[model samples]
Target: MRGSFRRYTRWFIAWASLVALGGWLLPPLVNVERYRRRLKSELEQELGRPVDFGAVSVRLLPRPGFSIQNAAIGEAPGFGDEPFARIERIECDVRWRSLWQSRLSFDRLRLEHASFNLVRRPEGGWNLASLIGREAPARGGTAAGSPPADAGGPLRLESEGARLDFKIGADKKPFAVINVAARLDLDFTRGNVNFRLAGEPIRTDMSLPTPGRVELEGEWTPGEKLSGPLAATLRTEGALLYDWIPLLTGRNPDLYGVLDLQADLRGSIYSFQFEGRGTLRQLHRSELPPPADAMPATLYARGQFDARERGRVVVESADASFRDSILHSSGNVEQVFSAPQMDLVVAVEHSRLEDFFQLARRFASGAGAAGLSGRLDGLVTVRGPWREPRLGGFFKAQQPRFIAGGTTFPMSDLDLRVNETGIRLAPVRVMVAPRVELVAEAVFRPPAPPTMRSKQISAPSPPSAGEPHAFGLRGLQYDLALSAKAVPVSDLVRFSRSLGIRAAREVDAQGIATASFGLTGKVWPITPPAWHGQAELRGTRLFLPGLTEPLHLPHARLEISENRIVVDPVTAVIGTSVFTGRLEHQGGRSVPWTFNAHTSQLSLEQSALWFDVLGHRPPLPLLARIPGIRSLLEQRTAASSLFAGLNASGRFSVATLTYPSVTLTNVVASAAVSGRTVQLGVESFRAGGGRGAGDIRVDLTAS
Candidate 1:
């Protein structure tokens, strides 16, 4: 048994030695330069396309091969002036047995830093059609790894650091799959081509911020159009929503979310079916940090894509969820590579109310998402062109409390509707204060954003990839109307302060007011709100700077506009007496308000008291620091030396005037008030029904 084993081992060694001698010595013995011409010819004949290469050098360590620099394969007819594949360097291994036959052949071809261009013609033809399955031409040549004559090589190709560019007709696209390493085995014996590829996708238009790797491995039969059966996997990691949306909208809004997806494709290349799932996190519309208690969103899809008919995609199943809130959609999308249009219906049901859904927050911002606590049930229909899509839907939330500026406003429900014209929310009710209920409604119209020609456009339902958020954040314009019951003026001020109004926080007053006002404005820095409506005042009182007594106001109609306030039929009440007049306030630094009041049957002594209350003034703040100056500057006409800064004009009638020196009956006087000075024009006076008429000007000042 030992001798039999020894004999077999010796025979094996002898056979290996002979094989080594044939493979090692013959290729070096032949002039390596002559093999370069043979290689060019073989590749041209096999591929049926022109081949070009620069210089060539031999490699004999560990393997025998040649290194060719600047190699390129010519494009098919009518494609472009550029080559189909351009390589920085090419390396191929020599078949030793073929060299022994006094001819050269390559068993393996490796390419470095190569770039491949794949073009699709308008007529639905591909540039790679001529090369996908061109059978070896009828020529006398050595098959790969064989010891025969004639120029030939195998169909095994490996490449590193390569890029695949896509083009429509002669125009190249800015998107590419780059830094790719691939291996392809074209096994004619098995009538199939097996390929494995790994690469990173790059989008130059918006400079994709967070990119990820994509890999594919599949086998195809050449004669069957390389689609006898195919399977591929697509994966995306760390993708940002802003990067994809800002390219078209020209605005980088406040979303800082990340999306990760993994998908698998199966079937022929022309008609492939796919399924994918992804996770979305950190959905926020402002620079403020995302809510700490917010949960990430998830998405899934299963669909079949047809490359024919301008690229059709029919979704079999699509689902999205944010915790307990879920949505399901399915439909078809056509013209994917051009002006895509989708007819998909997304039905959503939000079961959890606390801490709003991230998916909902992505579409609705500011007041729309504020204190959205209730269960939501709705359906959204996505349809029409990609750029000018019409979203038709109705969403309602219940059992919620709206909060703004650290105040929780009690609200029972919210309803929103979207149609082709715009987004609208009608009749939203909330309890602003204990007994005052506020009813508000608003609407916003979004202008159609321009499209990026022939670029990938994604519809935003659950915030997949689009600029719908831009129209909300930067270009939004809404008309808001608010109607309220009799709200206490203090509560109104406090509520306004809670909403971040500086003017409301600084105001001090006591009154009850009810208003029905409407305003229109753009939600941008360029425009301020324009308010127009009417308000009613009751039980109102205000202490003026020039008067010590609080000016008790009478019921009046307030007409309000952008820059002015008008109080018509102004009134004042004193113990068992009432006076009527008019008041106007122009929003300006000069004399913000002016008022005039008059009363008949007033006693001269009582009328003197009314004049004192109406014409009082306070001194300058700094001058008031002096003891005597304060009392002198802040006094009625009986004490003040400086002019009182106030103005009013009216006519009064007196029943009787009593003084220690004299008693005058039936006194009529006209007064012009100007800056703490009373210009009195006594038209006439009577002492016992005997009338005397006179026009006399008198200055009423304690000089």
Candidate 2:
């Protein structure tokens, strides 16, 4: 019995060894080339395309699978000879049990270094339509239908180093995706698919003009009727947006910026709902003019879009933020692919003024910038037919202060309202000093289409054919009213200096003055509108160096008109002399201004007041140490050369004059100045019982 058992065991071991050896050697001995050729033909018939391969190899040990090297699939008939897809290497794994049942069921597929060229024929049918067992429907839609009978079972697909190109007719599109990697699972039985896809990193391809990367995860249930919801989350970060802008707009803004977006997508393939938050950082133009301090910003949006309507977007909520300022808005934009139309309301509440200046500085051109400080609250509504935009809004400043040159103006209540036609400002009251208050009100209207005045031009001529015509300069009109109550002249002098005007620094003015002015005009016209006002000074005392006694004005009144100002009478008391004068000065710039003065009595020692007001100083440096010259030299610098650009003349006469000890009667003089030249004619002079007349000329061209 033992011998028999040993014989059986030997036989069993020998059979097992033979079985293992056969399993290992069968794959090498089988005619895999013939099977490969047959399988290619089967696939061509099933896919309705031509398939070709370089070589094929079979494996039998771990699992039944095939590997093909250098394979390609030809395009559909009439779609050109260019292969639709090509692969350097392809691998497929099949179920072993299914092979015995005469069925080829792919369990796994992988491709390396593959490329696909998809085309849309002139007849509006895609090369891939037949592969998916669906006829091309109208537009981008698919017809309702069940899955084809040949639709395979569930499978997993993976690919690396893949490229995809698209073409319409015979022309290649501008966009192509390169260096793609993806893993996907398709369950045809359950009609569901899930995938993870990633594109090449930015700047990895030198041949690509616009380089970018996309990372996405998506899942969807494809109903039998080809209508169902899909959802995806994607992240795309790239430097491609700058290049893409020109493709649509026909002009490159040459912007240097980085764009990054994280978004969620939900809806059917035909229409989608999107929610996203993104940022544009370090945004500025590189080759053209750009703003300084271009602050980076954040953007958030939730909207719905339909693929069928290519140029419309509906934004349910949109928000943008730069620094401490935020704009919250919602609107519908139409024809985005062409001439866009927008209707939106942007609002901000409780925002800092410094943040607003950060945006305003971009538009400021010079030292005139109103560098303001405080808080702001505002709302702006913008509506557009696109070409003709209309804007309306209002903004309020909470305790705003403007700092410029060297002075500060604290405005307690400032409000601004704007509309399509004009702008209005609320009355503002400012405190300049302990006892001084300034009140101002203003309204401004922007230019409208040229309105023909019967005297200006014949009624607008009709545009000639093929000739472009534009509206003439219409005119900007403004109205401003200002008043100052109980203010000292010293403060006014300081304010003048802050406005780039020179003033006497050696004089100390006392007492209070009240002034009011109103101006209305079309600033664009060569001749501005009329400006008239009045001023009054009461109990004002002025003291200067070298003067033993102060000069006092008990009362003074001045009247203004469109073309000139008239001082009815100004009586000044100096020492034992009293002088009264009526002065007239021409105003406005359409013509040269002139001055005339007639005085009943005058004190020569106090003549420096006229020189001070005229921004002039006598050439006497050493005399400054004697108090009189010091006031003239140290009070203000030499008069500006602005006189060289002005034309002026003056006439003056004094019936009686007192100078220290001498008194002159019937003193009359006339002066004329033009472009660095001065002329003075003494009509007559009587002093010390002698009378004389003469003319003096001064050439100040070198001075």
Question: Using alpha carbons, what is the TM-score of model 1?
Answer: 0.66
**Candidate 2 wrongly placed segments (more than 4 Å):** 1-32, 41-89, 95-103, 117-152, 166-172, 200-211, 223-226, 238-250, 285-296, 336-339, 360-370, 381-398, 403-408, 411-703
TM-score of each: 0.66, 0.53
List model 2 lDDT by residue over 1-703, tens digit each.
9999999999999998887787688878888876876667645643457889888888765668888899898898766778998999978777665586554656667889999888877555567554443332334443343223343465677889998787888877655667889787766555666878887532222232553677888986655333466898988785455654554444454555667889899986556899999887656444434655557778899998764575677889999888987878888777775677778787888877767775544432332444677888888777775544555799888988766566787777678886665556777877665556677776655433355211221112222333221122233466566778778876765555455543344445666678887665653332344566788888877655334346788777887766777776776776555656665668555455566666677776666434433324443244332322343444333333344554777787888877889888998999888876789998998987899888999876765
Clashing pairs in 2: 624-629, 624-630
lDDT scores of the candidates, listed in order: 0.66, 0.66
- How many clashes does each candidate structure show, in the order listed? 2, 2
lDDT of 1 by residue, 1-703 (tens): 9999999999999998887776676655667577667878756654557889998777664688788899999998888888999999988777777678655666778999999999888776677656655444334753432223244444678999999999999888777888999998765444467788888766666655524566777777645444456777777677776564563344565466777888888887788999999998877654545666446778899999987768899999999787777779999999887778888888867655554444545434343323445677777788887655667888788776766577888885778887656667758778888867788877765534446321221111122244353233345566667777678766776677677764443333468888887675665422556676777878866433333334566687777676777878767765335667676766653443555555544444443443334443322243432221234333433233223534555565555556556666677766666654566766677876587555545454443
588, model 2: CA deviation in Å? Answer: 30
